[model samples]
Target chain A: MEKGKIIELYRKMLEIRLFEEKVFELYGQNIVPGTIHLYIGEEAIAAGVCSNLRKDDYIVSTHRGHGHCIAKGARLDMTMAEILGKKTGYCRGKGGSMHIADFSVGMLGATAVVGAGIPIATGAGLSIKLRGTDQVVACFFGDGAANQGTFHEGINLAAVWKLPVVFICENNLYAMGTCQSQVMLIKDIAERATAYGIPGVSVNGNDAIAVYETAEKAIKHARHGNGPSLIECKTYRHKGHSRFDPATYRPKEEVEEWLKKDPIQNLKRQLLEKGYLLNAGMAQIEREVNDIIEKAAQFAIDSPYPPPEEALENVYA
Target chain B: MSMHNGDGKMRVITYRDAIREALLEEMKRDNTVFLLGEDIGRCWEGAFKVTKGLAEEFGDERVRDTPISESAIIGTAVGAAITGMKPIAEIMFGDLTTLAMDQIANQAAKIHYMFGAQAKVPLVIRTPFGGGVNIAAHHSQSLEAWFMHIPGLLVAVPSTAYDAKGLLKTAIQGSNPIIFCEHKLLYPTEGPVPEEDYTIPLGIADIKNEGEDLTIVATMFMVHKALNAARMLKKEGLGIEVVDPRTLVPLDKKTIIDSVKKTGRLVIAAEDCKTAGVTAEIAAMVAEEAIDYLDAPIRRVAEPDTPIPFSPPLEKYVIPDERRIIKTIREII
Candidate 1:
């Protein structure tokens, strides 16, 4: 990739990492309400896949969806406001972290129900096909969702119909606390795509360039009306399933090993080696990201809560 | 497409055909409208033949046959609806809706509100719910009350061909998720339907029969049972009013309450189980709103808390009938 494009991807990854860190800080201060599933380590997959999509293309996200929304161009202040349960936030504070969405950029809302958004993303692709539009939908789910009946049903329908949908599975190796080996006998989640007669590939999710290149090919295949494909990005979460539970289930060595290969750090090291970014450029980007996160947190704290009567509104239409 | 007779005459058709006509007219009127379900295409033409000949008319693209995944069927419809396509999905039987409850209740019913009015789900779920058929527990059920309890869903229960065609057309035109419930027994039953296109609003109630001595609030197949009981009561110098609240969620509370006030008596008849059922909701509404107008305590006619048995006699015993309506009415009067 060119220097400018690589820097763009690096900046996006940084935004997600810094934004989530700020969310963790706010949570510690008891300002961000409700539970949160931080996307701290798996930033490459969202940044990589969403970088290739247009503003008109649709994406259905999961519980850990803040990274996806940010990559899809959601404003950091609104996302922070939503997490803080403010009236000015996306969804008017009705939807907190788990349900945040910005339809203006085709972020088709995040569903907390495991694997439920799979078929909905397929439906969005079906709508695109029926309308004779070239738009595509990126369906994001976890390795655990691959076991859900919706995974089978949703992918089968999209495959049979040749709908423009790319199923991206972020295999963090563990669903909450149970490891992947305990649930499935298979090694790679992407291999399950053969059952639906679609191409499937597994790539290093910690490497931004690898994920972006793989997603580019899969998205092209979908845009050309060939069919849907599954791209399994092998990665891990940096925190527990939610903020409350401690992830002691993971081995100390395993956590330490994965933390060294963190997506943002990996991308930064690659950028420096390829002469895409200088030391001063890297420092400049980090300072800019930190400034943005601080402002978003302040805006969220300063925003007002929605009036009690506003709850009764928007129930219909 | 010209089912209308230009000459002044009432065009009659079966309840199943009325629903089919509504779908056909709406699909033709709006290119965005389409249909999808298990075995609803050309080969099967729907399990109840409600979509007979539609696949041939609209082609496989518009009238699509889907896999036996109920969740995908409704979930995809929700996706399509939010994306500007009006998809009418069929779940074959209402009992099977439990498999897709998350999509229906959590996703479709809550999306627009949860998303801060960013989108509207103009989707319709058409299914048959009743106990007249000997399909047993897995197939026979009256689950309209379940959808009624959902905040964002509009539950439409059409007892006759007129209401079926009219309410279904309205459901197609409106921008909301609707659970259109058709009764199994009423499918083949014939009734007078107008040739011209018409639509009945979702919240309106229709008085099938007017009387003065007592009022009977009924829905779906129970409306017919209540009317039959009303006729029997009329022969014995008693007058009974039969009111069918066609749509349950936006219930015609005003009409029902006014009927109760005029007759000074109320009896709610529904095919669902007696506890926490449609009858209970209406009975409670009347009790809260028109208690002072009642000359006697309210009575309820509903199925007992048991699944519909396969045996013919047992099935007949479990389903509410005209005899049960009459007994309940007599008690209230």
Candidate 2:
């Protein structure tokens, strides 16, 4: 990546980290109504992966999808207002957190049902192919979703049809408290790609450079009609599955160790070490990000709730 | 051998042929329309051959064949529909709908509502259901009630070739997702349907046979049975009117209530199970809307609450036949 591109990637990771932290704060203050799955530690994967997609290219997200939505160009205020159940939200308070979407930017909504987004992305890729467009689709799911049937079915179909899709599995070590070792036999979920006759690779999801390089190559291959690929981002969720439990089931050493390798801090240090960002510039970026989040929070708090009667207004065409 | 079959300006055709013709006509008219499902191609010809010679005309992309992943098939269709295309997805048998309930009920039906009406899911899920084929419970089922319960979906249960052809065309062109129910046993049944380009706006009830004593409201294959029972009851000096509500969701309450007020008796007949079924829902509608006009309590003739059996005698015992319809109508009258 060029210096400017590398700096932009670092900025994106910082934005996502700050955004998620604000969500955690707002959620703690009881501003958010429904439950949320925070994309706390896995910021680099979303930023790196979405950075490679065009505005018209599609993406399907999972429950823990705030980072993905923001990285894919969704307005921060609308997403925050959505989590607060305000009518100004992207879904008009109907979808809340997990279902927030902006079709304008080709974010095909989120599916809370684990692997359900896989088939939807593959289908969107199929639609692109049918319409004879060069648009690609990036499907984001967790490691646990790799075990779901939709994962296998979706990958197999995309392989056969050579649909322009990239399946990005953010293997956060634990799937909502259950460690990967407890649920999967294969240590590398990327190896499952062989079954579908596609290329599979595991990358350091915390390293934005590694993920961006890998994703750029995969996306290029797909956009050129080479077929779909599996990219497993080996990362960790810094927080619990939702805003509930403290993730006490995980060992203390493991949690502490993953926290030390936090992607946001790592990217900041790298940018400084590489002379791409100065100490003053880093401070400025942090302050700017804080200002943006504060504005988004204020907007979310001031937004009004939808009228109770509008709930049934959009149930049909 | 007469083309018109003595009907006004329409040719006689089987229900299967009418459905096929509808697909052909719509696909020809709109380039965005396509068909995709398991066993729907040049070789399989759609398991029931409803798509015979379509793949040759439309090619593999238009009449696409899928693997045995009903979830993927439907998910793909929903994704495709919301994006731009009008996909007529087939689920072979209605019983297999259990395999795809999430994509159909949760995803396709709720996208328009859940997204604050940002998108229109113009998708049609066509499936052949009903127990008369003796294909047993897994392959045969009358589960229109399952889809009718979903808020965003439009449920269409066409009983004749005319309604089937006209309604399928309208469903393909409409803006909402539709569960197009076609009965397996009714596919070969023939009726008069016009060949001219026309469409039946949904929510209109088609009165198959008119009478004065009672309104025998029926659906799918049960409409034919009600008509047969109407014929048998006419010999006994009993006038039984048969009403087929072509589309169940946007039900024609005006026609049904009018018929009930005129006859003062109603019997809701369906192939679904008796309790909490389509029959029960219709009976509740008639009771709620036109109770004062009723001469007697609304009766429902429906399948017993059990899985359709494989043995001929056992299956015959559960499914409502002409004898059951006639007997139930006589009691209600």
Candidate 3:
């Protein structure tokens, strides 16, 4: 990859890390209501996969979806407003963090239900194939969702039809607080993809370049009408399942070991060593990002709440 | 097959023929409209023969059949609807809706709303409900009340042949998800339906028999029973008014209330289980809103809570017959 492209990817990863840190702080101060599922350690997976996608390519996200939205080019201020329950948000404050969607950018929508979006993305791909378009759909789900019935049905159907969809699984190793080992006997989730007669690969999720390269190949194969592929990214989350979880279920050594491979820090070090970003340049980028987030926070705080009567407005049609 | 104008009104047709005509007309009107279900296009002509000749007219792609997996059938139709196709999925039996409740209630009913109205799920789920055919409990059940509890869905129940065609046409053209409940016994029943194209708006109630002594609000097959009860009570010098609220979700409460005010008594009849059924709901609505206008306590003539039995005697004992409906109205008055 080019040095300039690598720096750009690093910058995107930094924006996501700092944005999530700010959201965590505001959530602590009671500025945002409702529960939130953070995407702190999963930044590389989103940034890497989305870097290879075109404007018309589609993506369906999970409940921990902010990183995917930002990486897919959704405006940070609008997404923040949505999280704060403001009318100016992507869904007019009706859909909070878990349900953010911008169809104009081909981000179909995020579903809070586990594995529900898989068949939806497959159906979208079916639409593309029927229209004779080369467009592909990238469906993102957690390791927990792999056990859902929709996962089996959706993947099998896509494989049989040769639909243009890339099933990206971010294997954070836990479904809520339960570890992956407790649920499945197999060590690698991608290995199950072979049962559906599809190519499956497990990649180092902490390495942005590896994830980007894997996703690029899978997406290219899908667009060329070869078939669907299952690409599992091995990663970890810095926070618990949600805002209320303290993550007591996980061991201390595991957390410590995974923290050492933080994708943002790894990319930052590579960019600095390669002469793509000097100390001054890094400081300027940090300042600009901070100012943008500050404006987003103010916009969310100032936006109005939806009218009470509007509750019954969108029930039908 | 000659068209006739009696009393300067459109000619009469069978309810089954009306439904088939609606499907034919809608398919011609919209290229995206398609049909899918089990034996829907078979030469045997559907279970009730509503989709009799559609397969030959539109070809196999437009009129398709499927394996008996209700979940897969409904789920695939949902998938088709969201991706720009207007699919009319048929659930062969109303009792079978239980097998696909998750897809119907959780997925189809909630997708558009959960996505913040970004997409419109224009799908019609048609099923035959009610028990009078002696087809036993598993095949014959009135489950419209179960769907009425959901918020983002429209429920339409057509009683007359004209309504069977008109309401269906309206449902196909509408953008929201619709649950079109047809009565199994009413398929071969005939009534006056226009030969030309026409549509009746949903959520509107039709007053079949207007009188002064008592008001009877019913749906589907029960509407015919209430009218029959009114005829039997006429010899006894009792006046009975019959109201059929075609759609259950957006119920025509105003029309029902107006009829009750004029009659000063109300009796509701339905083929569903007596407990928490459509009849009970209508009775409760009247008790809550129009209690002051009532000269007597509201009455409900409905099937017993037990399932419909295969034996003829047992089934007759369980469901509300015309005699039971008449007795209930007499007690109320």
Candidate 4:
């Protein structure tokens, strides 16, 4: 990666980490309504995969989708406004955090249902292939979604047709507290890809550069019509599943061990060591990102709720 | 290509031909419109011959065929619709809708609302309903009431050739998920349909025969039966109004209620089983809203709450026929 590009990636990872932290804080204070699935430690997976994508290349995200939306170039104000249920949000306050979408930037809406977007992304890939466009779709899912019928059916169909899709599984080791070992006998989620006759790659999701490189190769293969690829990003979440969880199901030692490999810290260290970012530059970037986030929060706060009559406006068309 | 007249007017055509014409005209007009179902294009000509020559004209890609997997068929259509493809998936039989209820109810029906109206699932599920053809219980069930209960879906059941063409055109152009129910018995039945492109809006009910004594609201095959019953009632100087609620979900309750207010009585004739069916819901709505104008209790003429029997006589006994509808209307009046 270029020196400037490395710094930009680090800045994005930091922005996501801080944005999520702020959201967590606000959520605790009852400012953000409804439950939130935070994308704290999984920031590198989104940053790495989305770095190689263009504005027209599509991505379908999961419930933990703030990082994907930010990384894919959705405006911070729109995302925050959506989460806050403001009319200025990307979906005009109709979709909450789990359903935020900016199709103009190729973020084709995040889904609250696990594995439901897999077939949708594959269908988008099918449309691209049939139209003879080189556009590719990146479908994101959790470790738990791998067990869904949609995962098997969607991946198998995409593989058979050689549709332009990258199935990225962020195997965070827990499906809302159940560990992978307790759920499945297999150690690697990537091993399931072979059943669908697709190439699967496992990577250290904390390493943004490594994730980006792997995504680049998979995206290139997909765009070339070589077929879909399965990428399992081995990562961890810093927070519990939702607002209510105490995370008692997880061991303290494992949590501390994973915390040591935080993607934001790793990226910042790499950038600083490579002479891409100085302390002053990093501080300035933080100030700028913080200002943007503050403005977003204010925008969300100032926006009005949807009118009572507007509830039935978009039910049909 | 040529126009012919019978009885010194335009010639009549079957409801099946009207549907085929609608598909052809819509495909020619919009490039996004496509067809998919089991034997829709090639082998058996759509099981009811509704898509007989479409594959030859539009090619297999546009008029595609699929394996007999109702779930996958509906699932794929839902996926395609969300990704900017307007697909019309045929369920082969209305009873098969049970196999794909998850995709229909949980996914397609809720995609727009769940996604906060950011996405539109502009797909139509076309299937033949009702038990008059004696195709047995599985093939002959009426499931429109099932789909009508869903909030985000539009249910259309056309009884005439004109409606078969116009309502389908409306369904294809509309941005909502539509359940277009066609009665198997009406496919060969003939009527006059306009040659021009047209659409019947989703929530409007059509009054077939206007009268002042009792209002009859029916759907699919029952509309024809109700009309026949109206003719029989007219011989005895009984004035019976027949209203066809083309779309069930966004039901034209105003039309039915207004007619009931004028007539002071109501009889909902449906081919589906009576218990908790679409007729029961409409009866309850009318009783709630138009109670002041009612002189008699709202009567529902429908099949018994049981699977359609394979025997012809038993099937006739179960499904509401014109004699039963006429008797019910007379009793209500």
Q: Estimate the TM-score of every prediction.
A: 0.98, 0.98, 0.89, 0.91
The ten-residue window of minimal lDDT in model 3 chain B covers B1-10
Q: Which residue pairs in candidate 2 collide?
A: none
Order the candidates by DockQ, highest first — what do you get?
1, 2, 4, 3
Could you give candidate 1's per-residue lDDT for residues A118-236 as a string of tens digits?
99999999999999999999999999899999999999999999999999999999999999999999999999999999999999999999999999999999999998999999999
Q: Please tell me which model should have the higher DockQ, number 2 or number 3.
A: 2
Candidate 3 DockQ category?
A: acceptable
List ranges where model 2 is wrong by over 4 Å.
Answer: B1-8
Q: Report the C-alpha lDDT of model 4 over B54-89, residue by residue, as the tens digit.
A: 999998878877666566577667767877778888
Best model number under DockQ:
1
User: How displaced is residue B283 in candidate 1, in Å?
Assistant: 1.0
DockQ of 4: 0.37
Per residue, candidate 3 scores C-alpha lDDT tens digits across A1-317 of 78877877877887788888888888999988898999999899999999888888888898999999888888888889889888888887878988888777778778787877777677677667655788888999999989987787678767876889999999999999999999999988899888989999999998998899999999999999998999999999999999969998999999999999999888778888988889898888888888888898889889998787766667888
Considering only N, C-alpha and C atoms within 3 Å, which residue pairs clash in candidate 4? none
Which one wins by TM-score: 3 or 4? 4
- Could you tally the backbone clashes for each prediction? 0, 0, 0, 0
Model 2: per-residue Cα lDDT over B39-110, one tens digit each: 999988987888999999999999989999888888888888877889999998888888888888888999
- Cα RMSD over interface residues, candidate 4: 2.4
Which docking category, incorrect, acceptable, medium or high, applies to candidate 4? acceptable
lDDT of 2 by residue, A112-187 (tens): 8888888878888888889998999999999999988889888898899899999999999888878899988889
B-chain TM-score, every candidate?
0.97, 0.97, 0.96, 0.96
